[model samples]
Target: MRGELSLVADCKVVRFDAAFDITRETIGAISDVTLARRDAVTAMRRAFAELNGADVPIICLLRNTSENGLRDAKNLGATCCLSAHTPPAMVARTMMTQVIQDRADRPVRSIERGVARATEVLTRLFDGARSNGPVALAQVDASLEPIIEAVRDGGLTRWLDRVWTHDDATYQHCLLVAGVAAKFSLHLGFSASDRNHFVRAALLHDLGKARIPLAILNKPGRLDEGEMTVMRTHPVIGYEKLKAAGCDALTLGAVRHHHEMLDGSGYPDRLSGDSIGDTVRLMTICDIYSALTEKRAYKPAMPNAVAMAILSDMKGRLEDRLVQSFGEAMGNGS
Candidate 1:
């Protein structure tokens, strides 16, 4: 039965002498549906739910389909609906394409869903801050739970390896920064609580950017002096917002100082050297790396080697120890 189920997972023309019987036998298998009647969709959905595969994409074939057929396909999470008269090879090709596409899209969809949830939390925080209402740290913790879980589960690298962005650069950028920051923290011997705090700071480091105008935020080209000045206030803005919401000192420090350079050249306070602590230094490295690697309307993303080289060149601006640490963690042969 398991071998038969394996065959079904790979089959382009899936058939069931009796839909209920076959579905009962094929738990945990993803199969193309070359044949299904109106009632079959509901039965399949039930079976898929039982198999813990409710979201699995099913390819449906029918002699003729009405609006109800389409609705049924949607309910069953069908990937495509094909005419029964379609040639076997064509059906096979179509099913294969859908299977490949579904596999590719899963990670992307996961990122999108995660980003959307995180954005909702940020939006609410921004709205509350604007109104000067009390915001709870518990809410922030709840909002970060999914991101923290993904990072801890060793899934962050899988998400980052896929070169795509579903939301604005800010949301995607923050998520990547947190992942990198968490990774760096692990390498630097941070305890679990310390790592979570580090990741939280990375997540909210750009909250101040929300106060900046959208015009400047999304601009593809260079900003003039005035716009640049406006752009640099994000760290302070983020810090104040988190502080008002009762975030801890570490988070506040990272949010405010992530942009501060070691050479007294950064924005807001512009403190240099030891004034910027190790946590901020770690955040800065991750923040810079994520920003450089991300695609923007004005510039294509640089390769990792190129970005690392650029970071290495700015030795005085960034901490040498942290840069070396980051490079070690992220280095490949190139």
Candidate 2:
């Protein structure tokens, strides 16, 4: 039966008689499960108990499709209960459709959890900064781990799609930058430690914005020259706050210079090429992409192609190589 199903669908079919055969890897790899056993309900209960909170669709192929038996199966997480005599082709087709639908629906099911956790942590962190309390770097790491894992499991496109819906402009942009930076670091195959540094910098890059007045920070229109000056001070403001909190120099540099351009055209500090380190350069790319693609009250969200084109046009200001790499990293080719 497993061999017949495998031939019909492009999926790995694992056969198990009982719940004892399940493992963590099994849970991670499976999109759908088939229970072809005499004690189907008993097996499903044990299987789901071992699965913990992992969400995988289950199909039951039982000898008896009695109403009570089907009810028990449905209550135990089975999506469909069919007689054991069902054809392999029909079962395979049903399983394939379920797998495809599951992937399509994953963003809605998975990303919300990660986004909520990240938002809770950011709210606490920004509020702490506003109150002049010590920044808890450990807590920030704990919060972002779920987000990173979500992006890894669900893909960057889905993560961005959900993040763009957030109502708070400041928190939305921070989350966007963090998600993009996490994906970028993973795309570039950065070491775990280095990736953590990039993500941490992205998350806290706008820490100083907490101090900015609501009128200016949440302005419905573009900032005028005076307001622009205040906005540009955020990098330095963030740098000072994080520095005082004992942040390492690498993170401090990225936080302070994420806006700095390769040609000394950026704000707070006009440090030119080579003077800008790789960490700052990468963070700048993620920051710009997130900002441009984000929808705002005053300006509509720029399309990804348009944003990438603008980055490409900045021949002198941004690092051309990194810009191209960032486009590829975002699944939008340079």
Candidate 3:
């Protein structure tokens, strides 16, 4: 009751214009409705009354709801009963759409605040190294904790979508890569230690980009040879930066070699297929996929199918077996 009261009252709203799982008694969402406690139902009634008869747009998970609870929910204004299996992102999207439809206003600023804070942290990490020298490696890990936690917590990808902004492509790209890499690592049956190493690498793979000028990085036009040459140095630069900060060999390898191709055509080392380790190969696949799918000033975002096709065509560049594995894991088939 206190939780609901505080949320509804503190927000100065009568109706809690959000979806929640009754079973969990937590706001934002619940996975099961049938498991909702009787006390929770009573609390909902009190919350509605506190709104002075305003219709609360309570969202319930229908699959778990008992018939009695259903009666109570309808009486208490739980007008939207979503499927229990609906992804939280989908639920948020659906609720937001309905809230907008009903002319209910909710502030999206909170989500934006989180993204803004993350962007600020990344900006500082990048800028600090440039102006002052090496920031503590621990600080780097701490700064990235929220994003890592969000990915681990599940449904964060969808939640992130609710709050996504176009403010910083670099930060967004890193987050996306981390999430995607984590999923891929899981698919490949990577041990927890190895997965952690992989995720950290994905997050910091573009650390060298911090040194690159924004003009070239954000350029809408194709890079000239000189600009391309400069851009290609990011891997080496990142490798040096992380190495200076005392990151492990696996992490450093990922940061430096993510750009290396299997055909001996890659830069900084040009190590061919056999020379590239499994981890680097994995990082390469993640890096290429993330880059291809991302929208840039110079190009539009490609569809997943197109991106996979291009990856497939890069037989000499990326490991073919890993590419096939990636496609299979992504449900597109190799």
Candidate 4:
């Protein structure tokens, strides 16, 4: 199969201080990045200078909405500005249907609507949804389906392997990982339910880590054996948490067994062979791929080829078929 590129559209990664509504904007080229607290012109000039010779669509985002968003973008050679408040889902859909498709003059009103919805959700979450107005997790869960539809093809995993892959907190990272995993599931010819399960697992696979001590969870160095033992409890912790939170069997399976391997080398349970089903297997593969490709305090993200090679060797330690498919996809990507 030709490798499908699902860029980030819907899974608005909100862990950072800055984000964008680039779901609709094509990235031809991004040059020098300039930050502006108030001056969009200065930022634009730097971006313009960076792409002086490159002839491609330039993309950038601002921290907050400035009156100069459009004007500054025009001068900076930016096709779009994805600010913190941009609607990720709308940006994704527009990029898919228009920018990526090379259509002209796509409607802006629809994108604005997407931004509005995203902002609303973001406000509720950051506003302490649990204790304040008490927004249900299901409400936030509803938001994910739309984002998933938008971001799976925007090259979220592939584009960030440069010098520094950005790191967001757990929840945002989960959304980003799920975006790529959901796309991978579709490419694998999984059914709608299957795809949905992957999306859910991808988003919540790390939920157990929330229980791990912060020292170990965010540790910059490799964990010691005792710390490793505590880390292994994440699967169980995550599974119980999800079960309590009412996650289904499929999602629970992924959360529980995402670490297990075919040859019986993984954690939680050294599940091997057919015991490791396709969905969990796929999650395992996607998890490794996403982690290696993401920026982290521990290490830099690996290149596609290098990560695949490591995965290939680990197949003896993981499931063979999943590794094969992952390798094929990586080759197709390259």
Candidate 5:
């Protein structure tokens, strides 16, 4: 059986007479397993216990096994079960399919974990804001690493695709911005410190929105003038809260001025070009791009090309050179 499997597969196949011979390390090292025995159900149970939480696929080939035995094997973690007479080629195909599927699912699982971690951090921070509890900068900083790593592994397109489906609009936008900022920083070859600061700023930029009334924050349509005025106060709200929590200068600046414009046309503070620091400038571009690309109840998500075009059109409002760099970072090119 081992020789047949080796002939069908392109990789080395190890044979073990007893299930006890398969160690956790061996399970981790192998792609898949083929367990053939008269007592296949018991063998499968033992194999699954050894697997613990590892995701290796297992195929059980049972001789004279009853339907109940096959069902028991499946319940015990067998990925597939077949009669012992089944051809080796068929088993090889099943193994290949499972391997391919596991590979494809890895990125998605990583993204899910990243988003979940970010959500936990954001929720704690936002809850702290509402209750005036102590805010932990360390926790917030740690949260960015998962997201940064996820973007690095999955690419910006895949990150965006997953984050766009997040349920909470506010959380979704923050996650989107942080992911884009991480990707942008990588593209520019920013140092580790700078990249960390960039993603940290993106994650906390909208922390002020936690104080905004939910009715206004989640409004389905355009805000009236009065609502718009209240809605625009998020940057200052976030800035002051984070400042009190002992955040650094770059974080405070981005939290306060991510909405500020280079042409002094933006709200909260109308500080023009030179007054707006580089952190805020880079953050503003990421912020706007995230907002435009994010799907909202009132509007469908904008296409990446259209959003880039909009940025290009804001020649006087956003830093022109930075905008070009941002275009390049997003793979839109100069």
Candidate 6:
């Protein structure tokens, strides 16, 4: 809601079908609209309310409504209209197009999901690393297998790559990290356990970034000295948060030292070379690549090729072998 007015908002494509989902207050010509249909007036109120202040134009897809609905929507202030019979997949494309045309916010709504599902299961396992809980590890193994296979055959990674482009800072960064880490692991010929390790580490590497003030993290320009110091502390902040939570060792290391480079130039302990754990090294590569490629709250994304070259140039700054592996992986597939 705030992004369009305040930050780098994608074009907004609100699903109008759920107008009455909140209040059967949903009425009007959109009753038959099944895909995203709920109530028309409710949809209008929410959409207009959001678009009222945002400079970005609204794209209202009315594919689910009747002819009367169309007239009603226009009368009510819908900008564009489509038939209820419009293909959902195509609707998705249209919404994305609208966002690109205006360079407004993305069409996806914030699906408020609680920390449940198997991802949480894995999170719990890594969270309680000291327990040596095989249960969490086993669940993760079973769950990640399909994900690994998908990426190997070029499924999950591609999907992650696609969605990563349009998500919020945290979601986008995590996906970017997951993709790069998976590719790095595959290139390293890691076993399933090692592969899962990279996946977990990459995904959760900056979970603590969620705790940082958005103002600091999303600063479009260069950070001033104090802000820079605060930003640098994210690793320690995330690390301590995890430590206090009693997370697993590898997970803790991932959150703590993903910023630390093989060269002493990294942060926190400033440990260089072999002192930094291998998992952290891999995550460092993932973190850098993902950040460079993903769009930020401040600006558009950097091209993959350009990002890769930068990483390559930073070889001496990171683990030389890890960089080589990462480069090779990128060259081989994506």
- CA shift of 111, model 1, Å: 4.7
Q: Lowest lDDT 10-mer window, candidate 2?
A: 25-34
Model 3 regions more than 4 Å off: 1-121, 143-149, 152-164, 332-334
Using lDDT as the measure, name the better of candidate 2 and candidate 4.
Answer: 2
lDDT of 5: 0.79
- Report the lDDT tens digits of candidate 6 across residue range 251-313: 888888888877788888898887887778878888998778777556776766788889989
**Best candidate (score: lDDT):** 5
lDDT for model 2, please: 0.77
Clashing pairs in 1: none
Q: For model 1, how does the per-residue alpha-carbon lDDT over 1-334 read when each residue is reduced to its tens digit?
A: 2234344353322344344333433312333443355455556666555434423455556554888766765566555677666665665566556657766665556555555566676666656655666554565565454554444443555546532353576766776786677667766778777877887777788878767887898888789999999998888888887887778898899899888899999878989998988888888889999988887766776777888998999989998877988987666311
Question: Global lDDT for candidate 3?
Answer: 0.65
Model 5 over residues 133-223: C-alpha lDDT tens digits? Answer: 8776779877777787788867788888888888789999999999999988988889988999999999999998988999998888789
What TM-score does model 5 achieve against the real structure? 0.73
Over 122-228, each residue of candidate 3 has an lDDT whose tens digit, in order, gives: 66667865674774566555434444344444433442453234546777777667656766776788887777677778778898888888888887768999999
Error of 3 at 159 (Å): 6.8
Best of the two (3, 6) by lDDT: 3
Quote each prediction's TM-score: 0.64, 0.73, 0.62, 0.58, 0.73, 0.56
Candidates 2 and 3, the one with greater lDDT:
2
Q: After superposition, how far is residue 304 of candidate 3 from its true place, in Å?
A: 0.9
- How far is each candidate from the true structure, as Cα RMSD in Å? 6.9, 5.4, 12.1, 14.3, 5.7, 14.0
lDDT of 4 by residue, 180-246 (tens): 5755765687777667667767766876776677788777768999999998998887787667666
Q: Give the CA lDDT, 0 to 100, for residue 30 in model 3.
A: 26
Best-to-worst order by lDDT is 5, 2, 1, 3, 6, 4
Q: After superposition, how far is residue 280 of candidate 1 from its true place, in Å?
A: 0.6
